[model samples]
Target: MGSPAERYTYPSPLAGFENAPPLPDEKNEDGKSFKNPPRDILSEAYTTFPEPLENGRRGAFDVHIYYFSSNKAYAKELWERIRREFPELRIYRFWDHPVGPHPVAMFEVNIFTPAQFGAFIPWLAIYRGPLSVLIHPNTVEGGEGVSHMDVERRNHSQRAIWMGERIPLDLDLFYAMGS
Candidate 1:
């Protein structure tokens, strides 16, 4: 029998994806086969958002800007600046202490369209300073009458995107409320 390292030389478990089947060639209008090109994700991102993210009121995502007690001054200043700069966005009041699932003090911002997300996220990247941001999608996944808390828990834990340091969320609150 070969040694463990030698046995895994070519098709190693870690590199298994390298052996995946090639993407199918696209059929052009003239009935010719050509290599399917990758989509321009950045350019298309400004216009296309998933249909599930279409909430009637509060928009597609929640952006949480978290701060420690030490950096409260800077966080507060940033929050004020966001309010002044993006007057169209739904900006919530700043909380001085941890609220709901969040571990630290944070102010919430809701953005509706993909264009807004493309614009504001980059602007925030430059201006956010030492604060960590949590961006989670909001969706009505189960259609008409299912529990919304289940969806909230999934979005906060599974679908969340973090900028800078990621904080551990207090998911026990979700469990309590969901029950």
Candidate 2:
């Protein structure tokens, strides 16, 4: 093996972009000035969500914090602290037993805006001692009188983001709904 420093040298994933071509600035190839400049459009803080999702629901995401029955006390303590800290968030009641698709006891927290998502998720990551957190986007295939339980299933299983141990969900709950 080479020296310790040289042995670990590997090209960065971004190295491919080093020689990438640059896009035209503000003006297009035709040289016609664009009405909305890139800088002007994003001057303010981007702390909002795409509200009223396709299904016309306000919450764009749901954060489920799960803990086993053995850790009920610790989980309850964390839930209380969350209530005190993030009063703005829609924190549902702490269930001591498994509820719906959740295979274990969990408390659901709905996130409305990007700001709440940015703030609360990281806080939970740091403070959720020995807890599993599931973050899933609410993706509804919008239409009139269309049952989208399949979409919901994909959201929970395929598109879900898990922090810490990934608890298996009882997917039968979705199927039982009978779309």
Candidate 3:
């Protein structure tokens, strides 16, 4: 029999799949295949809003950090550290239970500018300490009157980045907010 390494050197199920026909490229005018596309093209698109801070607005995005009440001590310590470290940013008090459309207790952190966002995200990534964060932008412009449920769905399902265990949210509460 062959050596152990040689014996187990079998091809993966998708070994030859990479060279197969690629999916249709939506951005291309001719709907051509995206075979061996550039690395940038394969990556997900980043979210951007149009002229968010044009008129002296405070912010364009709000980030929420979710934690269970059972770990109140750790959550409080984390919250205090954030407040102390980033005094310029706005941080809200901790909620013990569900608030707004959120199904679990969470605190809010408001980021007013791209500079603040750039500084805050990386810091949180390293120091979050057993917390799940949900980051969403404030897309409401003019008087569009978009419901909170729409925002929550877009954030939790598609846009928001999760740092830890993603908890289920009560999207229905967003609809009830208008009542």
Q: Which ten contiguous residues of candidate 1 have the minimum total lDDT?
A: 7-16
Worst 10 residues of 3 by lDDT: 43-52
Per-candidate TM vs. native? Answer: 0.73, 0.69, 0.62
Tell how far residue 48 is off in model 3, in angstroms.
Answer: 10
Winner of 2 and 3 under lDDT: 2
Query: 50-92, model 3: which lDDT tens digit per residue?
Result: 4422224645667788888667688888889989999988899
Whole-model Cα lDDT per candidate?
0.83, 0.75, 0.68
Candidate no. 2 TM-score: 0.69
Which scores higher on TM-score, 2 or 3?
2
- Give the alpha carbon lDDT tens digit for every residue of 1-179 in model 2: 24534423333766535876564567656679754434536522355444223222447788899988788888899989989998987889988788879988899988877777788888988999999999988864645544577567667876689999999998787877844
lDDT of candidate model 2 versus the reference: 0.75
Among all windows of ten consecutive residues in candidate 2, which has the lowest summed lDDT?
Answer: 49-58
Judged by whole-model lDDT over C-alpha atoms, candidate 3 comes out at: 0.68
Which segments of model 3 are wrong by more than 4 Å? 1-58, 142-157, 177-179
Name the candidate, 1 or 2, with the larger TM-score value.
Answer: 1
